[model samples]
Target: MTPLFIFLVLLTSQVLGGLNNGASSKNVGGRRQPTGGGGLDENIPVIEIRGEGAPMSSAQIRHLEEMDNGGPLDIKIEKTFVPAKCPQQAKRLDFVTFHYKVFTEDNKKVYQTYGTGPVTIQLGTGMIMPGLDKGLKGMCAEELRKVRVPYRMSRKSKSKVWKNIPNDENWLIFNIEMVEIKPYTPEIQFKFLDLNEDEQLTNKEVQDFQKKMKKEFGKTWKNEDIDNVTAAGYYIKYFDVNGDGIVTEVEWLKIMDRDEKLINDKKTKEKGRKRDPGIGWILDFDNDGIVSYKENDEAADRFDAGPTLLPMESKDEL
Candidate 1:
């Protein structure tokens, strides 16, 4: 019980306490062990603990890389083939014809235009998905590309689907080959129609154009052929905004602009609606948007009544 004994005891107790503290602070698996109170060490960094599951697939890995690059949901373009000379690359509002095969993330083919005819659509128009519209902007004829469209940029939900094309909350892959590009403008169309170079389209010229189109299409015309030929047939009746018999360049351009605006306005108003009536709704003779049972019956009767050639004056009066 002397002073020397008490000092030795105190030193031994202090040494034991230091050893325990050192053991508690030892690193385990590169992370600092928790202190004695069972709380995480403030110096230890946070670690994400993922549960065991199937290993990440290649597609998932690529998606992660995309996210790291800050473009996970952005459209991805991989040029498979680039022609040495791209004289005419597609631009906004240009008429482009292309063949494409659409696939899901697992490479399951959803839709395609291979055996069938290539699709022709005006770029920057909402005729196709937004991702595709932007992806095809700079493509040249014969050029091939692989485009990855994230779900966010594509049509989602069944209501937004178009033409029964597969549209779900998943990434869509497209293998596209540009077939042709045609510069389209109202002036170009008008010039082509005014073959005599008089800058005015007469009824005979319009009829001739329609005949030429019928010959060119050659018995392959479907009900959905809404092209220049159809427009020409209706020009004298509907597009000649004035009572003039011939359509001048100014009149043609003005009417064309007005019609385009009307079509665009209709599309905007019916953006999310199912069943766009298109031009076929004219059969809804009662002026109602929907085709009623009575209207269908009348149409059937007209079909059964045989084709009768009504006088042009009578037709105009009707």
Candidate 2:
């Protein structure tokens, strides 16, 4: 072959070799692939359900397998369900004040993992975890439900106790029990049966009213009044509903009105007695006017004098 012709042939061979190498590299990088049956793109997830006689998608099969294996796969869960007997999806208030028991995919109780408290969020307000709010919105009184909520929607920042939750996508399972649904009443009306406080009462003034009610009137008072006043004082300091250092009697009364109803209601037993009082036991259930049974170790610790070993107290003394 001529020298020039040989050089041109070599150049053509090198160009074809380079092109073949580039195609092979693209295949190795997974940039190009053959797809059959209109399969979903690899980047997007596909869901399919299978039965004895039905069609199923790849994603659905994987979802079922993951669930069977206790949710081993990373998946987002979102669903909304109303109570079976929901009277009206819009006017669901009473059922909204339910106590929920959150659970995990492994069937572990979340309350045990995190210390216990009712996931109590007022229905309409944005106070609750979003998934919880959405789950409770349409529930009726005395309904039991299980709903799944994606971690993205859960109140992560609020739950300092759930310390080790993964920051990425997660799901929450809630087992909700609709215990009771009742009317919403204000605290002042329940307290004095009067909305108009003759004057703006201070914390001490509110306390004095209770003392007067007990002493002069010779009528017994529920210890909840004292606890409400104490809590309202703290709310005034922290929340400042009206931006006053002190919560006005009107403002305080309004809070009490909202909270007091909860205290008086029959369903209040769980929340009222279980609350941590910080000080000595402040609530006297059964209208007995004294701290008795239902008080736990945490409650007894409040009464020890001068840093005593709270656990050292005798059972009788406790």
Candidate 3:
């Protein structure tokens, strides 16, 4: 071939190869196209919901009036046992017994108690203040919730123990733990309530559930009524991402296993597990496995009332 012709042919082949490589690169880079449908809002967590305020019980209204007689007070969170989601079962007060120490903003010790066993308050009954009852509404067994009730909901209680709290209407901190939840028999109808895996439930969901229960069971029924209905209603509460209510026997077992794992983690970290059969020194707050501000050194910082708030000491620090 002529030298000029050979050069042109060689250049043409090189140009074709480069073009092919460029097309391949474009194909690889364009693999994932932009999806057009409304995507999950990246800003909000999957489980964020709230509603307008619901009707307060007359008693609650009265109590709140007395508490906020001054105004709303700033509240702080002292401690929390809430998982990502809370109040899983959503039972009224089937049975609750706890020990709590009231602390001032500075964590000063104010009131402490080892009181009331199985304090049974029906759900939606207005038997207890709306805040306390509502706080316990859907909590699962052994779930601990620490919420601040504005003075309006708490200040008028007959229990003088908490009366010392300032009425400037500061938030009333409640270190609540859902100790136990016993559902009625399946024969009556078992409704499954699921509370976990989210930051918090929207107030609207709470109100909607309450309204649905009232409409179905009659307004006279309180928390217990809703609890009973929940036990029977569709699996509205205990839904998975796929929205299945009836957890298969396998699913039930999985749930149990998962809960056991969580409980085990909590026990092992907070209080060392049983060991040595009868010879090991178990981590105990005041020689008791139960942790209370009155017992654990960690509770010290929690009850300190001073100008400067001290950070809570952890087990490692202790």
Best candidate, lDDT: 1
Question: What RMSD does each model have against the real structure?
Answer: 15.8, 20.6, 29.7
Question: C-alpha displacement of 96 in model 2, angstroms?
Answer: 4.3
TM-score of each: 0.44, 0.32, 0.29
In terms of TM-score, which candidate is strongest?
A: 1
> How well is each residue in 1-318 modelled by candidate 3, as lDDT tens digits?
111211111223343343344333312122432333242232332232334445555456546655765754333343456566544475632434444445543555655454533333345433355555556665666666666665555543333233444544344566665555555322111122212323222324434544543443223221132232332222223212123333332333333344335445554333432211010111122333333422233323322321121123222322
Off by over 4 Å in 2: 1-97, 105-109, 112-117, 158-169, 185-318
Q: What is the lDDT of residue 286 in candidate 2?
A: 32
Estimate candidate 1's alpha-carbon lDDT, on a 0 to 1 scale. 0.59
Across 104-184, the per-residue lDDT of candidate 1 in tens digits comes to 989988888888778776565345777987899999999999998877677622322234456563678999999999986
Each prediction's whole-model lDDT (CA)? 0.59, 0.41, 0.38
Worst-scoring 10-residue span by lDDT in model 3: 274-283
Report the C-alpha displacement of residue 191, candidate 2, in angstroms. 8.3
